[model samples]
Target: MKRSFSILSLLTQGTGLLALALALGGNPPARADENLFGFVRGAETLPKGHYDVYQTVTLRTGKDVGVYRGWDSDTEVEYGFTDKLQGSLSLVNRYIYNRGVEELDDTNHLTFGGFEGTTKYRILSPFKDPFGLAVRLETGWLLHDEVAGLLEHEIYVAPEIIVQKNFLDDTLITELNFGGEWAWGKDPAEQYYKEFSLQGGVGVTYRIAPKWFVGLEGHARGEWPLFNFNLFEHSVVYAGPAIHYATERWWVTLSYNYQIYGHGIDELPRTQTFAEETRHEIRFKVGFNF
Candidate 1:
C-alpha cells in the first residue's frame, strides 16, 4: 500500500513538471508582433539584452491649393531592459517647401525636427495568452512643428495603449492603438499655445509568404487648439495599404495613407482639410536587429 501511494505521488509530480514546461516554452514566433505594421504597433518586446536600430522617413504633400511638401526623418535605437519592457530614443529632422499656401509663409529649408524618447511595456503575449497588450509613453521637444512645417518651440507628452490578436496559426494578425497627446508651445510671434489631439488606428495583416506580410491600416485624429473642448479645430481620417518584408536580421516596410475625410471650421470650401495637415502621406521604415 505504501508503494502504491508513492507511485501515485511521483506520477502527479511528473505531470505538473510537464505542464510547466509547455507553458514556459509556448511563446510566439520570434518578434512576431514587433512592427508588423507601419503605424499600429504590436505588444511584443525584445528579449533581454537584445537591441535594434530603426530608420523611418515620412512625406506629407498636397495642402489643397498651393505647393506644399514636408519630409520627416527619424533614427531610433531600441534596447530591451527586460522581456517585458523596452526603451528607445529618436532624433528627428524635417524639410519643408512651401509656395503659395495662405496659412504658411514661403520657406524651403531643412531644419531639426526634435528629439524624443519612448518606453513600452508588454503585459501579455498573444501566442501565450488570449491576446497581447502593451502600454507606451512618448515625450518630445520640438524645434520644427510636425504639421505646420514651421519653426517653433514645443514640448509634448503622448501616451498610448496597444492591443493585438492573432488568428490561423499566426498567419493573420490584427492590432488596435489608441493614444492622446498634449502639447505646449511658443509660436514664431512668441505667443504661447496649448494643443491636444486624440488619435486611433487599426491594422490588419496577412502572411502570404515566409517573412512577408501585406496589410491595411486606418487612422483618425481630432484636435483641440486650446485647453477648451469647445474649440474643436479639425478632424481627418486616413486609410491605406502597407507591405513589409523581414529577414532574421533586417526588415523594411512601406505605407501610404491618404486623407479620405476632413472637416474643420477653417478648412477649404468643399474640401475641409486643415492648413496644418495634408491630403497624402507616405512612410518608409527599415530596421536591423542585433
Candidate 2:
C-alpha cells in the first residue's frame, strides 16, 4: 500500500512539473478564461486552435461496516478542433482501501480504472446569445481488474446538455447541467446487468480577482436497475464549495463535496463491499493551456 501511494504521488508530481515546463518553455497563445469548475463542467469550449492538459485527483471516503476509502487520478488532454467543438482523451487510475471490518480489513487494491474520451459542441455562445448552450458526450471502457472486489469490466456512455448565464459584467456566472449514463457488463457470476443513472447539477461562481474565483455547486444523482426498467436502486445528493486560480498559461481548481443524503442499495455483502457509496468527495485539478 505504501508503494502504491508513493507511485501515485510521484506520478502527480511528475505531471505537474511537466505542465509547468511546457507553460514556461515557449511563446504560446494568449490564455482565455479557463473552464474553472473541477466537478461541474461549464458550457464553454476552448478557443479555436488551442489546447489544454489537466491532471485531477479525487478522494472519497465512507463509513459503512467500517471505513472505505477510494482514490482516483485522471490525466487528460483536450483540444479545440474548431470554435464550436472540442475533444478530450483521458487516462484514469484508481485505488481503494478498506479497514476495521473483520471480513474486509487490510484489503487494499490499486488498478487502472479506464480510458475515457469526450466531445463537446457549443450550440450558442453567451457572448453572442442570451445564454450559452452546449452538449457533451463521453464514453469509457474499463481496462483493469476489479478493485476491492467491485466489477470493472464494463462500457459506459454519458450524455449531457450544458446551459450557462453570466451576470454582473461577466464576473458572476451560473451553469446548469443535465445528464444520464448507462453501463453494461457481466458480473463475476456471469449475471448480466445494466446500470442506468440520471444526474443533474447547478453551479454559481463569482470572480473575486483578476485570476481568482469562488463558487458553490449542488448535484443530484439517481440509479436504476435496467431489466425492470422502473426499479430505483439508489440516489445521492451532494453540495460543495469550489475555488479556482488561473494565469495566462496555467490554472488550478479545488473542491469538496459532501453527500447530504443517500438512500437504497448502499450496502452489499463482504465480497462486494467496495461498491458501497461514499459520504464525501474531494477533488483537485491543475491544467496548462497552450
Candidate 3:
C-alpha cells in the first residue's frame, strides 16, 4: 500500500503539471511568498523572468554535553521555472559524535536529498492594485536513508492559500498565508503511517530603497502522527527580520529567525530522559531564476 501511494504521488504530480500548462495560457505572473529566514509568509513582489540564489550556514550552540556532539547542514537550490512555477532540490547531512567514547561506539552520520516541485495560481493580480488572493500546491520526495534501514522514505502534499494587501503607498504590505500538508512514510518494521500538518503565518515588508527592502515575518507548522510514528507529533514556529536585494535575473536574501521553539525526534522512546525539547534552529536560503 505504501508503494502504491508513492506511485500515486508521481501520477498526481504529473496531473498537476498538465493542469498548470493548460491554466497558464498567457496568464499574468503571480506574486511570490515572503518569509525570509523562517517558514513565515511575506508580501513579496516577483516579476517574470527573475531568478534568486540563497546560501546559509547555521551553528547550533550548546547542543553537546559531556557525552555527545551534534552538527547538521542543509543545502537547497531552487529555480523559478515560469512566472508561477518553481522547483527545488535539497541535500541534508547530520552528524552525532560521542564525546568520550571509542571502539565502534561513538559516532553516527546520515545524509539525504529531497526533491520538490511547487506551482502557484493567482486568483487575482496584486500588482495591478494592492489586494489579491492566490493558491500554491507543492510536494516533496525524500530519498533513501543510509543510516536507518528501517526508515524507507516519505512524501508530502500540501496546498496553501495566500492573501496580501499593500497599505501606505506600498511601503507597508501585510500578508497571510495558511495551508495544510499530508505526509506518509514507510517504516522498516513493515508498517505505514500518515499525518496532517497545519502551516500558517503573517508578515510585512518595507521598501527601504529602490532596490533594497527589509521585513519581519513569523510562521508555524503543527503535525499529528497517526500510525507508525504516533509518538512524533509537535509544532514548530519561528520569526525574524530579512533583507532582500533584487536585480533583473538574480535576487539574494539574508535573514535570521530567532528561537520561537518547536519539536521533533528521529528515535522513539528516549532511554535516558523524558523531557520534551523545544525545536529551534536557524535556516538561510538563496534562490535564482534562469
Candidate 4:
C-alpha cells in the first residue's frame, strides 16, 4: 500500500511559512558558525541567553533493488546554557516502506523513532584562537519498528569533535567533524547485537551574499563488526552541495547527497553483492533564533 504522506508533502505544507518569512525580512545577518551541510557538526555554540528551535526532514532511498525507503522528521529545541555551552533535545518520527518482501503483504509502517539529547562545549574560540574547537556528546533511544520491520529497542551514544576555521574576514568558512556511535540493541527477532561505526565529514561554504551562502560537503562512514572490532564490514562515501538562506530571525538550509563510492557489504546481499546502503539522501531544515 502506498502512503499518502511523504517528505515532499511535508515540504509543500511548509511553503507558506517560508514565503511569509521571506516577506518580512531584511538583509540576512552574518552567517552562524554551523556547518552548511552534511552530517558534520561545526564548532560554534549559541550565544548566551538565546534559544533556537528547528525542524529537520530527511529522505533516504536504498541503493540495492528491493530494499527499503525511509523518511524521518525531527523537531529540536536548543538553549545556550552559557557562552561556552549549549544543550538540545529532539523528538524523531520515521516512516519505512519495504519492497520485494514476499512474506508480508503490508510493507509500510509509520512510527515514533524516539528521542535524543545532546550537550556541547566549546574549548576554543575561533575569534581569538587559531581555530574553533568543541566537543559534543549525544545519546538517543529508539523503541520503534518502523525501520526494516524491526522492533529495535536500541540505546546509542555518540561523541563528536568539531573544528572550524575562517578566512578572508570570515567570509570563507570550513568545518570538520569526527564522530563515532556505539549501539546495543535487540533486533526484530529478539536477537541482541552490539555495533560500532565511525564517521567523518568536511564542509566549506562561501558567503556570496549577505543572506545567501553556498557550500560543498563530503562525508565518509565505516561500520565495524561487533566481535571483530578491527575489521570493517562496509564503508561508503557521499558528497554534495548545500545552500543556506537566513534572515535576522529565521534560517533555512537544503542539501542533497549521493553515494560516490562503496566497499564490502554496501548493497543488499541477495540483490547485489553488498548489504543495503543509502544511495541518495535529501535534508531540509528550518529554524528560528530568539
Candidate 5:
C-alpha cells in the first residue's frame, strides 16, 4: 500500500517547531535521552513515564545518475515504561524526484512510506556504571523498498547491541552498535523472498561548547539473499561527521555521510555501491522532551 499525507502533517510539524522556539528559555534537560549521533545509537533510556517527540529527515542522493533525489520525513514519539525500558512509534513519509536516471524511470511523487515500533532495554548506565550497554529491537512493516523506491509488502525485525563509554569527565563520549536484520517480504513483482543483513557502527562525540557536540561516526553493512552469508549480495561502508545541540526542551542533530567502500554481487564497488545504495546521505533530527 502507498500512503500519502495531507497538509495537516506539515502544519503539525511547523506548529511543534514554533512551540519549541517559544520554550527555548525553559529549564535545561535533566534526562539523557537526547541523540548524540545521527546514525549511531547510545545506550541511554528515558526515565520512567518520560515522553519525547522527535522529527527526523533523511536525504539520499548521488546515485551516479541523472538528478536523483529522495527524502524521508519521520515523526516519532517515545515513552519510557521504566528507567531501563523504553519504546517508540514512528511514521515515515517519502518523497522522490528524479529525471533521466539510468536505472530508474523519470518520476516525481510524495507518499506515505511506513510505520515502525521500537523497544529498547538498558542493562548498564554509562553515567553510573563503568560502561553502558543496551539491547534494542525494532519491528516494522513497509510498503516501499528503502533504497529502490519500489512498492512491496515487507515486514522486518532488527535487533542490535549498543555499548557506550564516557571519558574526560563526560566531555567525550563513544558508542558502538552491531545488529542483524531479517525480513520476509513480497517484492514489487509479488514474489516472496527472505533477506538478511549485518550492520555495525561506531561513533565518537565531544562537547565543543555548552549543549553543543561534534561527532564522527562510521558504518558498515552487508546483505544476504537469505539468512546465511553464503548468499551475500552487497556491502557498503560510510563515514561521516555530525553536529548536535541540546537544551532542556529540545535537541537537534545533523550529519553528513559519504560512501567509502562497498562490494556488489557481480562486481566490486571501489568507492561506493550504486546498485542498491547512494553515494551521499544527509540526516537531520529535532527532538522535544515532555
Candidate 6:
C-alpha cells in the first residue's frame, strides 16, 4: 500500500509539469480577458437582466470489450441577482443502458439531483487596453443517493481564481483558469470504491468569434485511503479540446476527453490478480441563464 501511494504522488507531479510545459509552448497570441480558475462562468458577457441556461449530453464508454452507453444529460441555471453577485444551481439526469449486465443493482437510473451556489465579484474592467482581470471564490456541496443510501451525501470544497483578457474589439480573447477541490464523504475515487481525493486543474479559452470559442484544459486527480488501506492511492490525467456557443440566454458546449490512469492502485498486495483500467469518454454540455 505504501508503495502504491508513493508511485501515485510522483506521477501526479510529473503530469502537472507536463501541462505547464504545454501551456508555455503554445503560440504567443494576443492577450484577452481570461479567468485562471473555476469551470463555472461568472459575469462573462452578461448584463443585469440577462440569465443563462445550459444542458449537456455525455456518452461514456468503458475500456472492456462490448461496452457502450447512451446520452446522459446535465443541466444548470444561473441568474444575475446583482451585477457582481450571482446565484446558480445545477442538476444531472441520465439513462445508462449497458449491454450484457445480468440484473445490475442500479436500474434505468432515475431519481438523482444535486445543488450548488456561486458568487462572483468583478474586480476590474478592460479599461482602454481592452483587457480585464477578475478574482472569484465559491463554495458548494453535493448529495448522491444511489451510491451509499438515501441522505448519505458527498462534500466538496473548491476555491478558485480566474483572469480574462479581451483583444481586437472582443473578437479574439484568451482566458486562464486554475483551481483545486478537496473532497470527502463517500468514495471520491470512483474506481477505488472507497477513498478521499484531492484534485486540481488548469484551463485556457480562446474566442474565435462572438458565438464560437475553443479551449484546452488539463486536470489531475489523486486519491489516498482515508480509512482502510491508508497507504494506497490512485492518480488520473485528463486533457482535451472543447467548443462553446451562445444564443441570447442559452449556451452550449461539446468536447472529446482523453483520460489516462496510472499504475499501483490496481495492484493490491492482498489481491493476486491485477486489473488494468484506462479509457476515454465524449462529453457534451449545454447551459442557460435568465
The lDDT leader among the candidates is 5
lDDT of 5 by residue, 1-290 (tens): 12336577777899998889768954444574978988899999998999999999999898776887889888999999999999999998889888877667788888767889999999999999999999999999888766556787788999999999999989999999999999888476233377888999999999999999998998889988867778778899999999999888899999998998977877643666777778888999999998
- Which scores better on lDDT, 4 or 5? 5
lDDT of 2 by residue, 159-264 (tens): 9999999888888989899999987773541234677889998889999999899999878888776645567676778889999998888999998888877775
Cα lDDT computed for each candidate against the true fold:
0.85, 0.79, 0.56, 0.77, 0.87, 0.52
Off by over 4 Å in 1: 1-33, 189-192, 269-271
Better of 4 and 6 by lDDT: 4
Show how many residue pairs clash in every candidate, following the order shown: 0, 0, 11, 6, 3, 35
lDDT of 3 by residue, 1-290 (tens): 99999999999999999889879774544334433334454334344555444444443322213343334455655555655454545565555444442222444555453555566656665556558677777787755432221245678799998788877777666778999888777343223366677889877778888757788877777766663335555566667876777654445666555546655555334322111222234445445544
TM-score of each: 0.86, 0.81, 0.62, 0.81, 0.87, 0.62
Off by over 4 Å in 5: 1-29, 189-192
Model 1 Cα lDDT, one tens digit per residue, 1-290? 99999999999999999889879995444552257766778888887788889999999898877898899999999998998999999999998888888767788888889899999999998778899999999999988787555678888899999899999998999999999999888476223488889998999999999989999998889988775678888788888999999987789999999898888765556654856678898999999887
**Ten contiguous residues with the weakest lDDT in model 1:** 26-35
Best model per TM-score: 5
TM-score (C-alpha) between model 3 and the true structure: 0.62
lDDT of 6 by residue, 216-241 (tens): 76555555655343665656666677
For candidate 3, the lDDT comes to: 0.56
- Model 5 has a clash total of 3
**Residues 200-245 of candidate 4: C-alpha lDDT, one tens digit per residue:** 8999999999988899988888877563566667777888988988
**Runs in model 4 lying further than 4 Å from the true structure:** 1-35, 101-106, 145-149, 189-192, 266-274
Better of 2 and 4 by lDDT: 2
Candidates 1 and 3 compared by lDDT, better number: 1
Q: How close is candidate 2 to the true structure, as a TM-score?
A: 0.81
Worst 10 residues of 4 by lDDT: 266-275
Ranking by lDDT: 5, 1, 2, 4, 3, 6
